[model samples]
Target: MVHDQYMSLSLVNINITSYCMQFIDSLCYILVILGLVGNILGLLIFSSSRHTSKISSVYVYLATSSSIINIFCVIRYALVLHSKTRIIINNLIGHVWFACKLYELSFCFRLISSWIILFWMFERVTCVSKRLRTLFYRWNASQLKFIIPCIIIFIILGCVIGPPAYMYQPRISKNKLSNSTIKSMNYFCGLPSTVSIKWQKYFNELHLGLNHYTIRCFFSELFPAGTIIIFNSYIMYYLFRTSYQFSQINENKITKERQRTTSWMNIVLILHSCLFLSSLFSHVVGHFLSVEAHETWWVLLTVLGNCSLNFYVYCLSGKAFRKQIIHIIQRLIILISYKLQTCKQQQQNHQYDNFKIENLIYQSNHVENINQPKSYGTKNYPKTIGINSSSPISEQETSV
Candidate 1:
């Protein structure tokens, strides 16, 4: 009886795990599709002709970085799905050098995406702060063009520290079967081999606790999160202060514009702060708990949220962004409607041409029947033969 109960419990656990895995996989797939769509729409909206001013450059950078991060999320989720399948594809991707490098680069992109938002907030803070306005007064179109290269360089420099801290390699383990021993391999992205050895040695020798994961997490995740929060808070404070100043002054178009911009930035800052905090919490929890099943879902949800939140914020907050999005949607609808109409017209023309051809063929066949000579049996032979000696029989018969 106890054995049966144990078996039943085991089966129930298996079913639950399967259900959870399926749900997580479905969620990840949906999030990946949404992230791609949202980020692409953001890129299109930000890169438009109307948003070419230096003021919009921060948004342009944010959009570009977010798109790249979305791509990385897609890849990461795909790998997770592959890994869950426990197939050869996962082995190839996980153990291969180039694949490992790509994975590392994804981390770099994630960091870059986070820091880019911080930079954007910094720009906002500077724009709002009276003391900092003069420092950035020279910022122009030419200066804005260099932001992309600077971001690239920043990401590269940040990623340079990753290789020594972590490495990807296949781990081998032995399992004892009923009759024999079996060896299996799994890939891990963790501490470098040397670091792992040193970590053990240091703990054994000096009883000290310092390791690679802690270092990587601190630099890549916590530091960026802290910086973003700090800058975002400053931006908010300065924006409020600036708004108060604007209210005290006499009304002018430029001052009104500045107030509007500050308001927009405040809305964006609030949304980003919420997104960043949620993502950071999930990331930190996943790292510490190491609960693969639940942690994966949490991490993916946070990533999807982070990737898509900005687009929604822009649409909700920025009048220009909303207008551009609507314009793009309208144009797309018009383009699709035009193509559909063209196809329908072409189909109708094709049908009409077919009908005309059919009619022509029918007429040609009727004419052929009329022109053909008709022969009758002996009863009608006299009529058939009496038609005409010189004229065609068919024409004579028709005349008769």
Candidate 2:
């Protein structure tokens, strides 16, 4: 009875795991598609000549950040999908080294994406604080030049830290058959674990404790979150203080407009940072806490949802972003309507031409019939139309 109950519980666990995995797979697929499109649109909006003209040139940082998020989303989803399938696992286990490297690459992308956001927030802060601008004016002017080098530097940093952060280990467990000394080994790609027992102590101390708990939790997440919050608070204070002074004096249209734009930009940045922080916390909870498989899956879905929802957040938060989206939609609608009208016109023209050709062919055939000679039993007669009379045919009558 106990054995049967144990078997049933094991089966239940298996079913739950399968369901959770399927749910994760579906969500990841959705997130991957959304993240690709959203981030691409973000890049276009941030990089557009007209959009950038109105806003600070620092927005280029956002475009770069979107690009990084796109890569991170793709890599993260690929890893999730890879883990869910036995076929993929079997294939990947054969090349464990490559799989490990791919995992490391994904970690690097995620890290880089977060750090890029932090850098962008720093630039925003510099733009808001006059004192910082004095110090960072040249820095802001040369930001375009630094974007590439900054990305390269971050990539190198990620690569250096990524390898130690996570270690992939393929496990082979031996199972002994009943009444037999022989044991069969089952090889499978398993969860991330220490590379070997010999290095377990060092791995836990350095990689898990120092690298993950300290660097990842703090610098990648906590420090950035705190800094962004502080920066945005300072910006809000500066904006309100300036606006109060402007009200006390004569209203300047140019300064007011700039303030409004900055306010809208701040809204977007704040909301984006919130989503990022939420995802970061979700990641920590899902991985570090002892939770059910389905719960972990839900947590991950939330993380990916953050990656996919940034464009929507921008649309909701920023007036300029919303306007750009509206403009693009309007342009697309007009283009589609024009193309449809053109197609309709072309079809109508085709039909009219066909009618004209058919009419000409009918007229030509009638004329040929009129010119041809006709035989009537014992007498030859001419075929005529619009006249009902039996008359002998003449050359003039036939010609007429």
Candidate 3:
């Protein structure tokens, strides 16, 4: 009876794990598609004439970069997380150098994108703060220089840490007793174990303590989360202040409309930061704690979810983004209707041409029958009956 209980418990655990894996797979697949389409549309909209007139050119550049990098982030999720894609990618980039470089690229894109977004939030905050308005205006003209240098710095940081974090190459281990080989590349480029025990211990200590715990948890995860909280707090405070001012100045329609637009823009920024923080918190917790396989999967899903949510959040909160979306839809509908009309006209013309050809064919056949000699009781009649019939009349007239 005890053994039976254990067996049942094991089966239940297996079933739960299976369900969790399926759920993760489905969610990743959905987010990847959504991210790709959303980012592409975002790129187009940011470059649109309407948006360029309303938003600062500097902000547009930042937004364009964010959308572009977010695309890479989604791709990294597909290559690293999704099972089928991971297998194909692994087979293609199974070598140590390629795998490490891929990881490094993922790290760089993710880190750079996040920092770009953070700076963007700061830029928004400056616009909302009355005292900083002048500063914001000045920065607008020269912000590209600042942004470029920061990106270069972040790229250097990522390059330093990303490649070294995963030092070991993948291996295929065989169990002679079981006569089987383990073919899973899940641990590809993970920690090294074939070295000496002393070196392995050192490697584990350095990798887990410095790279995983200190640098990743504190800098990559916590620092960004902290900044997001700070930035969002300032934004929310400004919004409340604006509402209060609007209440006091009841007759200022311009101020009220400005407030509404500011709120709309910041709301998108706040929501994006909130989602990012949630994913960061989850990642940090998962790093320090012992989590089940399903729990780890859930954490990973949240990370990708944050990457995928930006375009949607903007659509929901930014009036400009929605307007751009509507415009795009309208243009597509017009184009499609135009294409359909052309196709119908072409088909009609083809049918008319066929009809005309058929009529000509029928007329030729009728004329051919009239001209052909007729057989009447073994006698062949002359061709061109009309001419022959007319010849007798003309000859009678001449004889007269």
Candidate number with greatest lDDT: 3
Q: Write the per-residue lDDT of candidate 2 for residues 1-400, one digit (tens) a residue.
A: 1111101000122232576677767777777887877777677677774755454665575555656675576556445443344245444653476664464355455545655666666666766677777765655555543666477646655645554434544556567979999997655433345356544433232222443333544554566667667776776777678776776687688778866866776676678768767866765554344222212444446656766776677567656777887777798799999999999999999999999999999999999999999865745333543343445444445657
- The residue pairs that clash in candidate 2, if any, are none
Give the whole-model CA lDDT for all candidates, comma-separated.
Answer: 0.59, 0.59, 0.63
lDDT, residue 64, model 3: 81
lDDT (0-100) at residue 224 of candidate 3?
67
Best by TM-score: 3
Candidate 3 Cα outliers beyond 4 Å, as residue runs: 1-17, 90-100, 130-133, 136-162, 165-170, 173-187, 190-208, 212-214, 217-219, 251-270, 290-295, 365-400
**Which scores higher on lDDT, 1 or 3?**
3
lDDT of 1 at 87: 43
TM-score of every model versus the real structure: 0.71, 0.65, 0.72
The list of candidate 1 runs beyond 4 A from truth reads: 1-19, 52-62, 78-89, 94-97, 130-133, 137-167, 177-196, 199-210, 246-268, 291-296, 375-400
Better of 2 and 3 by lDDT: 3
Model 1, position 64, has a per-residue lDDT of 64
Off by over 4 Å in 2: 1-37, 49-51, 54-58, 64-68, 71-75, 78-100, 138-208, 211-220, 243-270, 290-299, 348-400
